[model samples]
Target: MDPELLTIVVMNVMNTTRLVLHYFMSCETENDSVVPALLAAMETNNSRLLLAFTEQLHAVDRRYWARETSTEWWDRIVMHVWDDEQWLQNFRMRKSTFLELCAELAPALRRKDTRMRAALTVEKRVAIAVWKLATPDCYRSVAKQFGVGKSTVGAVVMQVCRAINRLLLRRTVTLGNVQEIIDGFEAMGFPNCGGAIDGTHIPILAPDHLAREYINRKGYFSMVLQALVDHRGRFTDINAGRSGKVHDAHIFQNTGLYRKLHSGTFFPDQKIPMGDVEMPIVILGDPAYPLLPWLMKPYTGKLDSSKERFNNRLSRCRMTVERAFGRLKGRWRCLFGRLDLDEENIPMVIAACCILHNICEVKGEKFPQEWSAEVERLAADFEQPDTRAIRGAQCVAIRIREALKEHFDHDSQ
Candidate 1:
């Protein structure tokens, strides 16, 4: 009840009692017993009025101040009842993998209980973050499902994303066993290939400042993710959060991979004899990337049978990276839609998703066939503008491509 209204009611009750007492006193004619009886009656009436007001106030309190507790979906269904298939369907990981992830992230995600409320458990926190990443549900919906506040959902996501990048990124997304990677490519019919490099755009909301810079050739706001994946569809390196307007080749040149390849510090010194030239280990890229001595791209313009066969074989080897990206976006559907996050934090989210992808791939988790349907539509491949390469470098790249073509032709014969 409003305080002013309560005050008015009390005042009216008191005034009525006083008026009755005054009228009884005025009408009294030497009758002391009558005044006493009337005073007792007034006291009883005032007590009843007070009791009624108290009950009304209690009713108002129950109506407006009650708290509605959540249904405890995470505690009831996800923790105890969900099977492995249910876990994969919702969280995009098996039950064992989810527990392992929580254990690994517990050091960073663990929180202390305060007097205000008990802190969310590490498993619950990780589940909240993974649920948000694996699905396109909004924060409020996620909060409702997890029985946490909407803001808590957003905070837990950033917290877990940061933890994953800090602890697991370097270990998971690394160039482990380079010789094995090369051998895998060899089995795929591409000789001396280490990894395949490609770029895809991740959609994001228009920023408050310089929003135009984020718009890609597809005319949608996005951030660029440049990745290097080995032959088994695992990411070896990732560079994310550049503006979509930037070209792939430009982004590649700015990365540490470019520096390592330029300084000859990335790969081993082993080389294979191919006709007059010895071919060093190289990475495969598309025409959008510049041709370098250590980077092999498909032949452009008119091609003879040998060049065509070489392009076909190189493309076959490069498809690993493409499929890796498809699975990444397919499993983590958050990347398929515009991320509702700040531009600065977008990179961490992307990095965390890539790390999770590698973990799932290394663990041999199954990718659902239904998820792949969205890959072709959501994967935006921008056409890069013409890039200028040094004539000396271009000549070396041309010789390497020609030599690889001859090698493929000889194999075909």
Candidate 2:
């Protein structure tokens, strides 16, 4: 037995003995008829306390006596044997990129070694988290592969995910070089376009509270991940944790992105002349989003050749966001299956995945062809939400869409 644990047990026993002695002395001065009842009550209380203490000591003893698990798989196979390709296959990032992330997250995830056990190394902790996110394995499977306790795997995942969100999310998933994004979109035939926005459902275990709210139109429990991506299919901003039943427009309107765009603060003042109207920078969305001066969704109802051409162009550009999401879930296969984490922690994990996606993309990591097929299959499973266009469209927004249609028409000629 550990000296500290032995000392603690001895102290508890002494305190209980002293307490019993005091009770007996007090009961001696009480009525003779009441003495038996008092002793009975004290005996019951002491038995309960002793049972609880005995259980706790057994638990501590089991923990102390358990031999440390061998980490041969992680120590030898992963550390010494794997190459860059293997790392990318398993972790979805190259060894160099993984090291960079470990360094970035070290401050938050690093733990001190205790008397009983050595703390997990920073690299190992990060690897455990990334593997959990990148693959569909449950905690038990992950623990077995990594040679750690199942609970340790879960704790390490949350710790690393929270660290990634706290340290990297804002910096990695932001709109960078706005003019460059606009230029990229213009080259793709959408003038003055800043980004493409869309939403997808991330499947999750049904939460205990308000479980029905998470069921989407498709009849599965999920949370909405609304994302805005630049021309290169990199996420610029993401809004997650919204109930799956919510509309895309509703989620969009509630985001800080909406506020920034509405207040004319999201984009730069750059504009291009389309006949008499000066077109402000805009983001392209599908018909699910409302048409605004800053947001251009496709025209609904019957359309002529010119309007059709505009919608086609917009759809092509908006595919950036869709493909971004496809790649996101494709790389992080855990997102394809229902996440088994607590509802509160799911958002952090999602954000961490996005941050990692950006890193992999920016680093020019090659996405495997096999993952693309999985993404397509995942896409086919979900039905599109019913489009509910907001009523009372602004005249300026109408003019902007019309002007863009005419521009496409003239450009085709």
> Of the candidates shown, which would achieve the greatest TM-score relative to the real structure?
2
**Clashing pairs in model 1, backbone N/Cα/C closer than 3 A:** none
lDDT of candidate 1 over 1-413, digit per residue (tens): 76458768887987989998999888847867999898999999888888877776766644354345574677887789989999888888899998999899999999999997889999988999999999989999998888778898999999999999999999899999999999999999988889999988888899989999988877889898899999999999999988988888889999999999889888887788776787889999888888887899887778888778998999999999889888999999899888999999999999999999999988778898888976666554333323333223477778888888888888998
Candidate 2: worst-modelled 10 consecutive residues by lDDT: 59-68
lDDT of each: 0.87, 0.88
Model 2, residue 316: C-alpha shift (Å): 1.0
Candidate 2 local lDDT, 1-413, one digit each (tens): 66466658756875876687677767556467666666677667767766766766666645445645779999889888999999999999888999998999999988899997789999999999999999989898999888899999999999999998998988999999999998899899998999999988898899999999998888889988899999999999998999998988999999999999999998888888876788899999887888888899888788888888998999989999988988898899888888898999898899888999999999999899999997788767665455466654678889988888888988999
Query: Cα deviation of 262 in candidate 1 (Å)?
Result: 1.0
**Model 1 lDDT, full chain set:** 0.87
Task: Give the lDDT of residue 102 in candidate 2.
Answer: 95
> How big is the positional error of residue 187 in model 1, measured in Å on the Cα after superposition?
0.3
